[model samples]
Target: MSGAVWDAGRCWRCEADDVPVIWLGPVQTQEHGAGPFAACEPCIRRLEQLVETHHMQADRSA
Candidate 1:
């Protein structure tokens, strides 16, 4: 599903028309287990920021 065209209207991030949204989920690898989740670009960035902040806080506490 890499080259599949996603409808922009279904995106939870941008309101732009025909924005190519991708489904990033079910990241099951041999090393890591599977999880139920998906994200758009904006949401992915937000999650990254949140994780960074959480790690920073933990580091400061330690």
Candidate 2:
């Protein structure tokens, strides 16, 4: 999640509208309009946890 921002809009991850959102990276799916994808706080935290877990696994493997 690069260049993330806290805002109020639809969360691309959970599809929850009228809530707080953080704009992040590009929207890979064609279903979305343009880039600068939006995600809620919970989603961001989950993603951060996933990334941390992945890094830990990679470090152990290395």
Task: List lDDT for all candidates, in order.
Answer: 0.60, 0.85
**TM-score top scorer:** 2
Can you tell me which runs of candidate 2 are displaced by over 4 Å?
A: 1-4, 30-34
Can you write out model 1's per-residue Cα lDDT over 1-62, one digit (the tens) per residue? 35644544434444444555555556575876885344556766777799899999999999
Q: Estimate each model's TM-score.
A: 0.46, 0.73
- Count backbone clashes in candidate 2: 0
The stretch of ten residues in a row with the least summed lDDT in candidate 1 is: 8-17
RMSD of every prediction: 7.9, 3.3
lDDT of 2 by residue, 1-62 (tens): 56656799998889999999987777766677767788899988998899899999999999
